[model samples]
Target chain A: MKELYSLSAHELQKMIAVGEVDPATLLDAIFDRIGSLDKKVRAFALADKTKANDRLKRASEKKLGRLYGIPILVKDNICVKDEATTCASKILAGFRPTYDATVIRKLEDEGAVLIGKANMDEFAFGSSCETSCYGPTRNPWDLERIPGGSSGGSVAAVAADETIAALGSDTGGSIRQPASLCGVVGLKPTYGRVSRYGLIAFASSLDQIGPITKDVRDAALILNVIAGYDEMDSTSVDVPVPDYTKSLTNDVKGLRIGVPKEYFIKGLDKDIENSVKKAIDVFKKLGAKVSEVSLPHTEYAVSTYYIIAPAEASSNLARFDGVGYGFRAKESADLIDMYLKTRSEGFGDEAKRRILLGTYCLSSGYYDAYYLKALKVRTKIKEDFDKAFKDCDCIVTPTSPTAAFKIGERMDDPLSMYLSDVYTIPANMAGIPAISVPCGFTANGLPIGLQILAKAFDEGAIFRAAYAFEQNTDFHLRKPKL
Target chain B: MESIDSKTVRHVALLSRLSLSDKELEAQSRQLTSILSYISKLNEINTDAVSPTSHPLTSLKNVFRKDDLKPSLSTDDALKNAPAREGDFFRVPQVIEGK
Candidate 1:
């Protein structure tokens, strides 16, 4: 057999379950893969080889849980007891959590070995990985391009074989966009479907922790492990968790998919359009009906998301003042100087930009004009999706406008950066489940992702539809030569 | 309809607690103005009677549990690695003064 690192998470788990392979051997292979590729990709922030070995030893003793020694990478934003959870920001450079996040506890209970914390854009603000206090994560496909972000490290790590699967928090396309750019699968579960007890907040309402993996089956497996209600999180849903893997069978005979006309408009790249259209054709081939649907509020998604996400972000990040947690200025002339200098130095440019925009929108004089108005528009966006769901089991769109661009291409243009999320933001705003699956590559060899969104708590529909598409296409089977 | 100027940029920076330099303010002022103008397209849509939603799901009730004091992080453990720390507390410059 090939190196264990070369296999998908599902393949590894199945082999281990049948006693064809041992956890020790797989753990060593994972360590070796991380040692080789992580320096170039800058995938992980903190790794404890000793702890990983301990977990493997337990697995060998037959004391292992469901995941049983599968090497997993966690986004730096999620808290793991006794490990640094920096969120890739200087503000929390050495901060460590005393208690594990609820998801971490659940994963540990399943005997999944956490290999390390992956890097991300500081405070989960940037769409590209470039804004991390540590550094940018490079795409495995093309070293010169980005793996979409702020979950870029998690996405890049899986693509580069540093880990078979990883956890990422999605707010405004963070998980799905990076997965699209990196040519992997990223799932953003419905809001409140997973516990937010340990995730450092970026935008509480929009954020949900989900999985990014090499394949759809692996995403389903990870979702089953993490999705549940938790007493620790006030926003957690009380719904019963379903066996996500059970829905992966290629049986979408009567599923109806809606392709929004607004998403195929002029700004979308022709290559991406073709790739998604081809994916729809694949769905049609697999006994599903694909029809054109109108979502008129699509144009307002980017504008509304920018306003609403940041408005909430501005409030959530208020806890990071110099007085409480995170960074404080070295020497301050006065209280005001301390606050100014600490925040000025603590946050990256993107974080500051959002904070300012959010603060502007939420200011007393502007609240009724900007923030409140944006919320009303947000309702319309959700209503549009609610209306569309009446005719379709799931909605389909291009995960992003184009494949990964050159490193510095959109970094300097804030509006252009915002435009990158045009396709995926509405799903977050609507609190629906969405998955980004590889569809095809562009003429330039960059991968395109087909995004599938389902109604609230209907991740089963998303998995069934995505699995159907994955089964009908060869895109998910392709791997980066590197 | 809106063009953000240096004054608005300064005000926003103050609100966000960022100490932007004059150079940054000059550049960001133009950038913010363009973004705000682009988003002002919302002004064209008449939404007089529609109620704004703060959360996506309106059915969510207050999901809080009773505040119980579990084991707190020891003061030493909490402040051990702080960049700037004082005895049993995080030392910061005074934040407010008496009127």
Candidate 2:
């Protein structure tokens, strides 16, 4: 029998359905693996075996649902009732939600055992996992390098086999960037495709919750469980969701793929560039038409994202003022004084920096020049995708400009840290669906990622392309020498 | 682009309902200045005729659900995560002015 911890969620589900592996035994094996490895990987923020067992007991009695008995982790940013969903920030310390996030409820309905909460950037802010209040999650590939973030813990957990799959939120490439760095599959669905009812808001317009898994088919299978409209999230579109697994037909024949010339410019690591170009060749050889498309506003995406994301974040984060839940200040003379003290003491440096920047942008005088200007540029960014997609079925690029960097390499220079996400942020800005799958490795043994993006509601194209690529390569099959 | 100084940082922090230490103010001033400088690169693009996209990619907005008294959180559940609770209410900081 295959080691339960090492198999994909779908494979494990099949075994559990046939009674070849008891759900509790699979749970114990995964917990054992997490026990041995998580000390080095640090993927989980709250991985209590006792709590997971209790949850598993509850899951066993539910009606037979898809993905029954499979273990999945949730990113700390997404609320799980009776569990701490801190977004890895001190401000949210000691807080537990009374209700689950929409994704959590969906997974519970599928009878999947909710194992734990993965760590993340403090309020999903930084690219590397360093800004987490609990500290950074190290790459399973190399313990010295960082697991890319803000969904670092989710991707790392899947890579290190701490959990079979995970749920992560992407705002400006949080999910895809980490998946690239960790050599796993990460999908950021089209905005409004999945409900955001209880996801702790970061950048509301840009955020989307999606799956992180070991393989493309697993990604599609998990997407099947999570994708759909909910009245609770007003932004969720009431579009018909097709069976995503049906789209995983290992063929990309006649598919039109665009290789954006703008993404292959300066500052992109040569190994990643070579890997992505080779990936494009594979698509071409598979009878897919490839063209050198241009997304002219590509260079401006980072700048525009910095402004618009922070502006929205400032407003969304205003709720954490020591009023309803989470941490509160010790003593204060007045209401304003308490609010100030609690926030000052609770939030980390990155959170404060962003809050100040947002406040400055949305402040009276600068609103038109900064906030409104950023929004206008956002329209142009989206227009760039709209034009490119008109000429192609899907677009391909390198996921992160480079593979995972050494810890503390970009910590001092916030701008450099922000730049690490340059290749992955455009999808979020355009409100499109994107996926990252392993393509190759660097000389230093670091994994490289090939990103595939499609028009909104066309996640099918991305899955078809990615599955075709994965079927031809052994990259996804290779695990880190952990 | 206007530079972020300690005075501006302090004022912005106050507006965010967050008080920063002298060190944080100094650090944020230096960091925010550099970030804003990078964001200034957007000034090169001409967006005079473009409109803002403030919502999701969907056309749906102002989605009003049918007005009904559906199941809501019990008062105990609502106060579950609160730092402190006095019966049904969350114990917040003093809001009134009088002693």
Candidate 3:
């Protein structure tokens, strides 16, 4: 018998609709699975069964919304009113948000039960989950290897069947890269397709909340619920929310797919390179019109992102001072002393490093040289996508240059870690939508991700391509030995 | 040609309102030096003709809501997460040199 916990959100929804499965029994199975495998995978910062049960009881009494009675894990950075929403950093320790993030509100309004708080990089600062205060979330495929992050815990949870689906925030590959490494479906929607009202701000401009799920259809299902305009977020676009499931039909025939030649470079792992190339061939076989394209400015994505993301992060993070919420240093002699001491003690090394770097970029005389110059380069990056998208319905590339590395391998090397985001950052830069799907696995069994990039608010195209590719392959069906 | 030395790092840390120990400052100086050096590569691209993009969607403008009072968060809920609270306010260390 297929384990109840191993089923997808759609499957669970159907079973419950037919009265073949009880919602409470499903929750019990989910928590039971998490109870056993989480010690090895370490996917959550907090998995409160008590609170989930309370939510389950309440949800049972509600009318059916799209995701009725299905369990979902939310990234710690997204606020769940009256529940701990720490961003896996000590600074926000003991902080429970006073209100729900719009996405959280949307999910629960659809009868989706919030199961747990997923672990992440401290303040979403690092590429590896190692930077989180709760320690690293290991990849289910190989516990010794790292799960690509800062959404590592969310992705690992979904990959390990810890939950039916999860919500994660992507600020330059936090969602896609980790999804790639964990061999699951992750999508970063067009910049404003989803509201960012209650998500803890990282780099306000680059950060977006997206779904990390077991397959592309689930991604579409979650996006259907969460993607829409809200009065709360100014950045959210006033676009019509399409029934994304309608785009899930496996038909890529005559679709224009762009293959960026720049992504095939020396540093990309041979296995990943081959797997992505193979994914392209699969697309061609399915009648996708594939041809070489150039995103010439791609070389500058990481450097440009470092300048812009940090500058905004430094500004956004200024809110974490001791006065209002979260950790506060009590012994300080005065206000300024308290601010400095509280921040110094509460933040981890990576968070401190990013704060310093961001401050330096936007600081005094260096602003024009670093910050302004980066913004100009960002225009070029956006233009590259614009010119390429003119002829292509979507673009394809490896989500990361390499697969999951050892946990501590790049922790000491921040630059190397930053470069891993090279392929995934461009979508955020252009405010375009992108998805990462299971393309193949490495020789040692770590999965590789095939990323698809579609134009702004054209997430329907991404869903189409990703769903088609997923249907034509069995990579997503392979489970970890755990 | 700019490099991040300890003095520069300390100044930046101060600006960031973070108090770093000497060891952390030294390590930060080294790491920031390398990171900033890497970021400087943007200079290679001739972006003189391009306009800077602060946000990707240039179409979005100012967003406003109706000028009516809604049922906002109750003071108790607002102060619920405050590390130090006094009655309806968040209490903090004295500012502006007390009288």
iRMSD of all candidate structures: 1.8, 1.2, 0.9
TM-score of each: 0.96, 0.98, 0.99
C-alpha lDDT of candidate 1 relative to the true structure: 0.87
TM for candidate 1 is 0.96
Better-scoring candidate (TM-score), 2 or 3: 3
Ranking by TM-score: 3, 2, 1
Off by over 4 Å in 2: none
lDDT of 3 at A313: 89
Native contacts retained by model 2, as a fraction? 0.84
Q: What is the Cα-based lDDT of residue A442 in candidate 1? A: 93
Model 1 chain A poorest 10 in a row by lDDT: A55-64
DockQ of 1: 0.60
- Evaluated at residue A468, the lDDT of candidate 1 is 77
In the range A1-482, model 2's lDDT, one tens digit per residue, is 66789999888888888888898998999999999999999999999889888878888887878988889999999998888889999889889898899989998888888999999999999998899999999999999999999999999999999999999999999999999999999999999889999999999999999999999999998999999998889888889989999988889999999989999999999999989989999998999999989999999989888888888899988999887899888888788998889989898988888888888999999998898988888888888898999999999999999989999999888999999889888899889999999999998999899999999999999999999999998999899888
Instruction: Please name the candidate that would achieve the greatest TM-score relative to the true structure.
Output: 3
lDDT of each: 0.87, 0.91, 0.92
